[model samples]
Target: MGLCLLISCGESGKRTSVDPGTDTQDISSEESKPVNTPGKKTIVFFGNSLTAGMGLEPEESFPARVQEKIDSLDMDYKVVNAGISGETTAGGESRISWLMRDRVDIFVLELGANDGLRGIPLSETRENLQAIIDTVKNHYPDVKIVLAGMQIPPNMGPEYTAEFREIFPDLARANQAYLIPFLLEDVAGIPELNQADGIHPTVEGQRKVAQNVWEILKPIL
Candidate 1:
């Protein structure tokens, strides 16, 4: 697959099976609220459908898989999946404050891909992401931050696509946050890794994603 497929996959992946306008709004009001589990550290996976595991069951999502890994290690961290299908960076900026109600030990920020796909202004995307990071820092000064990098196809123009790729790392360095180079690393364009929509990852693909995340996250625990 070419770079175009990468960006195309993200665009379609964000909306999954629903209408773009209708589905990409707010994630479930219920899911937006984070519930802290007593006696456990919290890890919040915040992003769009990829984080939400759009085409799969809640347990089948990468966040859920991460939970399984933590359990095996007998770690006491709660993985909260705050992913919403079709969410954009602006949506995440607005929604993040609500999830701050509970304690968050590690925050994995995974929002920008949708904004990139929709041709949202890079400034707006960067600002929204920065705001999110700022809010997290303000709420929990000691919380660890993890930024997931995203890449889009050059359909948006080489300059735009290149800049989009730079956002995550730049934010990471600025915030001193951990960075996962690409959330969909091995799963993006592989036909078998993706679902029928050629967007969302299949079950096995999610596992690969979980591994990608785990590589960066395990040491934090």
Candidate 2:
């Protein structure tokens, strides 16, 4: 089982874009305003290598890039990169308590990619993810959750691929979490944006991912 850890960052950079319809933007002009007063709000991203920045620098990862964008927008929130390289949903479920140690205002759950890659039972993956959601909600009822969906390679077989693809939305609805239909979006399958492994994203690819996540994140922020 894989386990992704989240990290906090302090940085700023240019804005990125995601696909239309799913895109979200900020309307507030102020930067770093207190979102809830007194304490700072932290958004934790939970997942595997995709969220862990396996082949990329910590700063180049999508979570960091999103943090930079959020800072620029003046949203008083902290982005925590809790991505564990090679982690599965089962691994994530086991670490929810430690991960949620902080006062997490939101959670961006991005697990199950490795589970799909390893051909783990979809039912098992669903059970693990649902448990993670339940635990997080039980501990932090006010924490907003954003479920990052994934797609498997077509070679995984049509039936399995379809089931794997449907898990994210189903979990999002059941848990009442915000859904980002696909984490890779324009980045995945685009040879230019991906690294040599064809698994992780290039620097440009991560930027595209940040944009992809931002679209759904902006509205919630």
Top lDDT hit: 1
Q: Among these predicted structures, which one has the highest TM-score?
A: 1
Q: Residue 12 of model 1: what lDDT? A: 42
Q: What range of 10 consecutive residues in model 1 has the weakest lDDT sum?
A: 1-10
* lDDT by residue (tens digit), candidate 2, 99-158: 654577888999887677667899999999999998888889998999998887755688
How accurate locally is residue 36 in candidate 1, as Cα lDDT from 0 to 100?
83
Clashing pairs in 1: none
Stretches of candidate 1 exceeding 4 Å from the true structure: 1-19, 22-29
Tell me each candidate's RMSD, in Å, in order. 2.9, 10.6
Model 2: lDDT of residue 116: 78
Write candidate 1's Cα lDDT for 3-119 as tens digits.
324322234433343344653434455654567888999999998788888768878899999999999999999899888776778777877887888899999999888788878
TM-score of each: 0.91, 0.82
